[model samples]
Target chain A: NAGVTQTPKFRILKIGQSMTLQCAQDMNHNYMYWYRQDPGMGLKLIYYSVGAGITDKGEVPNGYNVSRSTTEDFPLRLELAAPSQTSVYFCASSYSFAGQGSSYEQYFGPGTRLTVT
Target chain B: EDQVTQSPEALRLQEGESSSLNCSYTVSGLRGLFWYRQDPGKGPEFLFTLYSAGEEKEKERLKATLTKKESFLHITAPKPEDSATYLCAVLPYGGATNKLIFGTGTLLAVQP
Candidate 1:
């Protein structure tokens, strides 16, 4: 089903440059998220959306912005990139029904490797 | 604040050897604990989910057990194909979006 897909498998950027990492899911999930994994570090949450047109900040939201204009797309924007932004970025999605008592299992994309010099 | 920690940062085991990886967590109210397997240059693949103490789930050579403050992932008669970074994550009670807080992960290398 091509569960989840992310564009730009690898990228390199100069400091102060800007770009957007594209993510799309075909699972019809209501919840989508963006996370960054650094070497020897846990996956840190950056931003998430419960549904289209709804978004919120996560644990590590600084230097990143996100928008969910459609159910299938959630894009992460990096403005004025810095070295600290060099990391593997992952996009994940899940389906959750409120009050259903079911645990949500997140499905992740292959991830985008970004390097800022 | 919610936090998760995995032990033995890295482990190397010979073929057919057995071992366990540990995940310790601290949170106000625990909703669920999860296990995922990640290979090099790829995203994590979900393995198991434990809801409460005494809960256990098994898949092939891996079994996951949960407790009040920690979780254990046991690998039995492991093969080289089982080598990967094992990650644990927690979903706390009262979380609005149900986001998971993940650990640094345990990197396992099995030699054939």
Candidate 2:
């Protein structure tokens, strides 16, 4: 199903540069998320959307922006990158059944590795 | 605050050795606990989801057990192919969004 896909497998940017990490899923999931995994820090949510045209901030949202213009795409933008932004970024998607107490499990994409120098 | 922590940060064992990895957590109310396997340079693959205390799930040689306060991933007769970082995550009750809190993960290295 090509479950989830992300672009720019690896990137290096000078401080103050800008870039966007592209993510897409073909699972017809209603929920999509962006997370960054720093060494030894696990994965932290950067942003998420419940459906197309809806986006919200997560635990660590600063220095990042996201837009969900289509059901299959969620892109993360770095307006002005900083060294602290260096990390591995992952995109995940899942479908939740209505009236269910628990959300469905998420499937992840091979992450994008970004380096800010 | 909701939090998840995994123990031994890293482990190494002979191909046939059996061991367990621990995931301790703190949350207002538990909804579900999850386990995932991640290989180098790849995204995490979902393993199991435990909904309540005493819940257990198994796949191949790995078994996951959940409790009121923690979860465990036990590896039985491991193989080199089983070497990877094992991650634990939780979904707390009352969270409108299905955001999961993840642990740093326990890196497992199985030697043949």
Candidate 3:
């Protein structure tokens, strides 16, 4: 399995510009998440999906949107990007379900480094 | 508020030396605690997950032990390749949500 994969390892966007960070997983994970890592700030969840057509806001979801249309793909959209959005974004997936003991561990993609100027 | 904290922001150790990284947490209740190793410019790699207090798990050169208040990642015999930023996260016991709270991480550098 290729596990989780993300597109555009790096990108620089102008203020007010928009872009989509694509993420996919071959592990058939039912759960996927988007997180941003700022130096010394740890990982903050932006959004997550329990399954296709299901999504929820996380700790930090401002300026971001997400869609999970399939079990393998979860894309994050940044509308009107701001400098505050400059950070490394990670996409992760996990096979999880109630009563399943072996699905809590998450697998992560390499991540996308985004800088808004 | 639920939170995770890792100590010793950074450490330098000689190759073959042994050491431990600490992760202290404050949560209402914990479902599991996870340890991850992240190399510079790469994503985090999962190491171990402890489900309860008094639990211990080991890999080749790493052993993770968990207590009620904290978890420790003990490196038995460090190699240069073992150097990385180690992160800790906690999955709290609550609703169906599986969100995790993360720590800032402990950076380890093994010098030869």
Candidate 4:
């Protein structure tokens, strides 16, 4: 299994720019998530999808958006990006959607490092 | 509020030395506690998952034990390959919502 794959391993964006970080999984997972990690800090959730056609905001969802139109893809959209948005972004998925009652383990992707100037 | 904290911030051990890392957490409900290893510039690799207090899991030289309020990862006669940042995370009750709250992590360096 390819597990989780994220596109654009690295990117540099100017203030006010817009971009989308793509995340895909081949394990046929029903749960997918987006998280950001800053230097010397733990990860903060940005958004997540329970399954195709369902998305929800997480701890830190400001200035970002997400779409889960298909089961295999959960893309994060950054609109009018700022320096505060710069961080190492990770995409993760799990075999099952624990549905507000489960604690299934999640598998992660290598990540995408983005810098906003 | 649910929070996870890892102690010793960092540790340096000789190849034959034995040591344990700590993870203290506070959550209304714990679905599960997780352990992960992360190498520099790479994503975290899953290690073990502990579902209940008094539960334990082992892999190679690493052993993870869990309690209601904390968890411990004991490294026995660790090798240089064990040098990596160890992260602890929690799956809070009420969801497999794909969200895992993580600690800053403990950086362990095993010298040969």
Candidate 5:
């Protein structure tokens, strides 16, 4: 079902360059999230969306931007990529069934590894 | 502050050895605790969800038990493939967005 798919399995960018990491989910979920993982560090939320046209900042929202144009896609944009932005990025989604409960077992994507030089 | 901490940041065990991973959290009124498995170059795979103390869940060789302040992921006779980083997260009250506070994770290496 391609639960969550992220584009550019791996990419290297020169400092100051810009790029976007694409994430799409076919599960028709109402919640989508973007998180970045650094070596030996836990995944940090970058941005998230409750549904199309609604997005919010997460724990580490600096150095990144996100847009949710449709329910099926949530893409992350890195402007003027810096070395600090070099990390593996993951996209996740979950159902909003419980309203507030254990329904947050987020399904993650394969992740995109980006290295900025 | 809302936070999650995983003990024994790294662990090494022989195949078939039984052990457990711990995830301790401090939050204001915990809503839920989540466990996930992440393989190299892959995303974190969902594992178990514990809603409250005394709650337990199992799948394959892993069993997760929750207490008021912590959670344990028990591995029974684990295999080499069980080698991966196990992550725990906590959902605090305030919103229904499932905004999670995650731990650094426990990296498990199962040698055969």
Candidate 6:
């Protein structure tokens, strides 16, 4: 099973151009997340969804938006891309069972490298 | 606020060398600590998860131990294939959804 898949493994964007990074998981996970990893920095959450049609802002949500229209897909949108947004993006998902004690071990997809010029 | 810090930002070891990578963390309340291995140009791969102090988990040549305020990933008889950046993350208690705070990670290079 393709645990998680991301589109456009690499991309070059011009400043102020907008783009959307696609992420899909076949694990039937209920929780999905988007994170950006800068050089020598830890992954920073951009957005996440609990389930279909439910999305929430994370630590670094500015300049980014997300939508979870289906259980298997969560997409991150950059309305106005900036050089600061140049980083490696990762998509991850995990399944949570009620009363099972928080076991949020996430499965990540190959990251998408974005460079803003 | 929850935070994680890893020591020796980078390490280089020859095959058969044994070493330990440290992950120190601070959180309101700890729920779980995780270890992941990430190769260049790829996303992190889950390695081990520690739930409480004194809890330890092992896989192949790697062992992870957890304490009240820190976690340690011990590597024994490492091989070149074991080279990767090891990441540590933590899930805090009292969150509606489990969100993890991560460390900068320890990059390990195992030379044969």
- Candidate 6 pairs with clashing backbones: none
The CA lDDT of each predicted structure is 0.96, 0.94, 0.95, 0.91, 0.92, 0.94
Q: Second chain TM-score per prediction?
A: 0.98, 0.98, 0.98, 0.97, 0.97, 0.98
Candidate 6 lDDT over residue span B74-107, tens digit each: 9999999999999999999886677889999999
| Model 1, docking class | high
DockQ score of each predicted structure, in the order shown: 0.87, 0.91, 0.89, 0.77, 0.89, 0.88
Q: Estimate each model's TM-score.
A: 0.97, 0.97, 0.98, 0.95, 0.96, 0.98
Which docking category, incorrect, acceptable, medium or high, applies to candidate 4?
medium
User: Residue A84 in model 2: shift from native, Å?
Assistant: 0.8
The model with the greater lDDT, 1 or 6, is 1
Better of 2 and 4 by TM-score: 2
Residue pair clashes in candidate 1: none
Per-prediction tally of clashes: 0, 0, 0, 2, 0, 0
Highest lDDT against the true fold, candidate? 1
lDDT tens readout by residue for model 4, B25-77: 99999888999999988898999999999999999999999998999999999
- What tens digits encode model 2's per-residue C-alpha lDDT throughout A1-73? 9999999999999999999999999988989999999999999999999999999999999999999999999
CAPRI grade of model 5: high
Candidate 2 vs candidate 4: which has greater lDDT? 2
lDDT of 3 by residue, A1-117 (tens): 888999999999999999999999999889999999999999999999999999999999999999988999999999999999999999999877877565487889999999999
Reference A-B contact fraction recovered by candidate 6: 0.81
Candidate 2 Cα outliers beyond 4 Å, as residue runs:
A100-103
| Candidate 4, residue A73: lDDT | 96
lDDT tens digits, residue span A21-47, model 5: 999999889899999999878989999
